[model samples]
Target: MSDASFLSFLDDPGFLAAFVEVSRPRAHGAGLDPYDYDRVTAPLASAHDWPAACAAAGQRYAEAAGRAAAEGRGVTAGEAYRTAARWYHVAGWLPHPDREAAARTAADADEAMRRALAHLDPAAERVEGDGFAGWLRRPSGGPAASRPVVLVVPGMDSGKEEFHTVVEALLARGSAVLAIDGPGQGVLTAGSAPEPDYHRVVGRAIDALADRDGLDPDRIAVVGLSLGGYYAATAAAHEPRVRAAALVSGPYRLAWDELPPFVRATLVQRCGGSEAARAFAARLDMTALVPALTVPVLVVEGGEDVIPGVTNATPLAAEAPAAELLLVPHGNHLLGTALPDWLPTAADWLTGHLTAQR
Candidate 1:
């Protein structure tokens, strides 16, 4: 019965279509230069030949890297790095237990950061006086005291770059944003850092940001994506200074009790072999913790999100002291696709709450 339900959900045309549309762009964006989407989507695009397709993609990436390097000046080094990173992202998604694959993905992200640093002015300044990780993005064109500031926390398998798209949008709107690599995320993923202790880590991040110059520390808001949502809620609860919090395609609970069997099975298959994955899963259970959150929150869920159903939203709304839910029709787990349309709404919501408090 579970298998049948799983297969049925996977076969849903709407689900598959949304998944493909969101995933394809991510895959394409992962690489530096444009590649034929047809070739890239050939194998792993579907379950029938996912394994073989992933293997093929890995080979293509490796071969492409060599060719680009040989061509030298014709293909800039930046292109090479992008191509390699794209392959690494694909390699990370492949359903295989290869320690080397994860290591390579981490290494590629590190290299991309290096290249990015060389070209872009250092916009990030480290925050001292805290054990927790924190960084600030200065408001451009002199300090604007009236501008709102946002502190963003990423989900599992996420790093600072995940906010690249959103940060540009916020900055254009005259908002300063601070993004952090919290425990078990980003560079911490490759390090010996401890798994996230929700309230503690977030509290530290807030404490560090509170004293930064040009920031209306009291007007600060928090946006947590995916698993970061759980942490964000907890932080909002403990920190009375946070004016508002938003969760983009985020869930209330850590354990995916509402996930369809196939999705759960897929996760198990993906992480089953890794001790680290197993440990991560075992520690993530936020159901009991939701009731403790007292801040005003906006829960954004995809209408067709198969992993966390409508039921998840209900409990969150009920549990949160003050919360509202926004369902994006035809949206999926990846929030960026709908961000351009939804961010304005989110920004307005944050603006109302943050600015009014002042």
Candidate 2:
């Protein structure tokens, strides 16, 4: 047998290259400062070392958060816990060979986020369902009984814990935010397969949040990034309860055969096999599906976010009759490089639509 045949996919040159390259922008976009990303990853030389290296950093911050909390330094504790959570969250992305251990690591990330929110926003609530989990929070000092709601959905290989900035942005604009991780995402990945009919997952989220006090059920909006963007668009088209949406770096279509091996492998891991991954990939295309969406939509595209085998959101924006497009030339897939230009604008767009006197 060839030595190559026995090697873990983590060691494959292409997998290593793509994981390392993609990790930075995704980390930064998710809340890690770029400088911290460099420093944390500098000593790492291989994908196999990635989880341990990141977890070590996460442990350090987690300890710091603990100490800060014990000292009654609430702000410091909050910041430390958030940083710790981000590290652990980053650590959980790889589809490791030790599936049980990988799942434990995911749980650690999930727990850290809960602690972070306890310190950061005491009002934050954890919401869960059959195939999803989320942190639901309202605007600071929001008015009683009808604050517009926004569902902040994360992408494939992303979780509810990562989009802190997006959640905060939406909260700042008077929207109650639910940052969610659905099937094949966040902590749920260990148990659930990816659902290409993501609208169902979202429908369940809406049902969970529907009767909550101080959140307007009829005024719900969605802001999703990457694969989550596709999910949000899917829900907007089919779930009539979704009043508005913002898509960030979502694919307009996906061709299974053309996808990068890392992406395909991730899907394979989540979808159960190569054939299932192929089937799910085919379901991701929105070339014809998005045109029927009637709610106000904002599609945010990173001009530089060219991924193999994926069609970007530009065409979705152009085709959806109610869509408005925001293109950022220097942004990476998640706009980690150009946040200021797109984040607020999109948040404003969503809140405006949700709060409009409709």
Candidate 3:
């Protein structure tokens, strides 16, 4: 609960791994299960092998995704979906350029999406925005052009690919979707952008979505995974155009004071050692900055979360003028796979707000 306790937890490598394992069910349920779950479970697990496993998983996922796209399944095919999930898992476990490698895996995912779209009606387009950018996926069937729109944001370590399942699910529900690589995420991190000032980066994403063709604009909803939740909440508050918002396995308060030690250690490890990790940590002040959002908001939390405790969601719900909280009993930090059950709830809530625009 306190900052010290959180930091202490982050310092222990064993504890971090254990917490991750415990969080697996949630991630698995959410469709983001990593490939190393079984391999990493061996006693005395070798950290060195983690990268190799991640790379292999990424390659496999790329191939599978391509196959799925060719089959008109949009990354939902058993092989492609599993591969994408493995990429998320592997990326989390892999090292530096490995993170970059994970992004590359995401690029393959983009290709898969493109391939799938090609099979559809080809309403997709590569759009350029102010601070951020992405490809917009619109429905292809007919001119029944009144579909709801969703703006999907990736997590801290995730890229646009991670939301492949989410996009498919929303699209199936007759909604147009836009998935983007926000700052410090995907292409932005690989490119010149630094860790973005949340407001500026997400505001630009909203700006981009609002201007797209055939989009209801008024029926736009925002969904953020992991750290994207913070950005989504902030954007929903400041940008009135976002009718509703959902925080998927994301925390409410920034927890500048209380990040679990395992998380800190993981960051340190991700940055390639302890010193760099500390330096990176110093740059972040996790305190929740958004006061109160008027938009209809859905806050999803993991019951056994190690990174951001379940308690974090409480304050966020309190901060939102109209908010609903869904606690996944066995969930972790990843909520994408849990879409089957959660998406409907999300769609229902969003429909109430977005459809009322008439």
Candidate 4:
């Protein structure tokens, strides 16, 4: 990477360093051991070099996965495939000046995810509707007699491929997972765009899961990250069937002026344009909506988060009929660094709430 480019990577508006650091744990979640993450990233000479290096790292892992599959090491192969998917995803992030390259990397990441899911425990089933797509995974040992289902929603840039760890955690507690790509997210962005009333999408997802066998429709829950947090709460408030909701670093209202230009641009693109995005952001206020959340609600926030900040958790929990706020003193956005502290707890809370109603 050029010296100028390196400085750009360190620039505050971009928050590149923080993005890379936070993404590390996610790569680990994708099965790249810590040592591998360091080894692959240690050689990055500049900001521009990282993506190409990351793409190369993914290729190397993909080759390894192929070899393992040939040797009948299904579990090992699955791990490698997942790791490759993460690396490819990392490359796809902030791919500037080369939109075509970014698209290709993103497609490769999705393919790797599919390959990984094939070897995962209980396997994952690909599900689709008119304008949405997702992958569903049952509990490890297979569906329980009557365990609940949790719909996992991703934030602006995150996709279903990055949610394998969340799925595993929920499955361990006997809850099946449906990690979805809503309108304008992941592979579901062909003709649709992001909407303020995401409950419309959530309601449809619930409808699909309700008709499925082995899942308890009455115990369904929604768990979201960042912007997804907003979507989850809105869904629970508007959809009477959503028994519980969990929000991780979601904002009650969009800090439009506070958002960085690039982030704002992405929002506009996802929301169909500037006017629509602004309209959607304006409609995101949960002041009146949170009071209607009749079911259990879990709001997790990091004290150090700059995007949504710790304050966003207040009104959410205060208005909800049954709600709890977990504040991690040193956590960042999505509480990525605090996963060990929050993931299990969030999963347990979801299980407890769903089970209590039974």
Best by lDDT: 2
Residue-pair clashes per candidate:
0, 0, 12, 0
Ranked candidates (TM-score, high to low): 2, 4, 3, 1
Q: How many backbone clashes does candidate 1 have?
A: 0
lDDT for each candidate structure:
0.57, 0.83, 0.59, 0.75
Which TM-score value belongs to model 3?
Answer: 0.74
Q: Is candidate 2 or candidate 4 better by lDDT?
A: 2
Clash pairs for candidate 4: none
Best by TM-score: 2
- Give the per-residue Cα lDDT of candidate 4 at 208: 73
How do the residues 222-317 of candidate 1 rate in per-residue lDDT, one tens digit apiece?
887776776677677767767788877665543555554444543444333234444555565556657666767888766655464323443576
Per-residue CA lDDT of model 3 for 132-183, tens digit only, reads 6667887657786766778888755566755666676677666787788765
**Residue 22's lDDT in candidate 1:** 52
Q: List the residue pairs that clash in candidate 1.
A: none
* Model 1: worst 10 consecutive residues (lDDT sum): 1-10
Model 2, C-alpha of 267: deviation from truth (Å): 0.7
lDDT, candidate 2, 1-358, per-residue tens: 2222222667776666667777787888788878887887777778778788887888899899999999999889888888888888888777655667767777888888888889889988888898889889988873575788889888878888789989888888888888888998888878888887888888898899866788778898888889988988988998888999899999888987788656776777777666777788888888657666989999999988989899898987778889999999998888888889999999889989987934
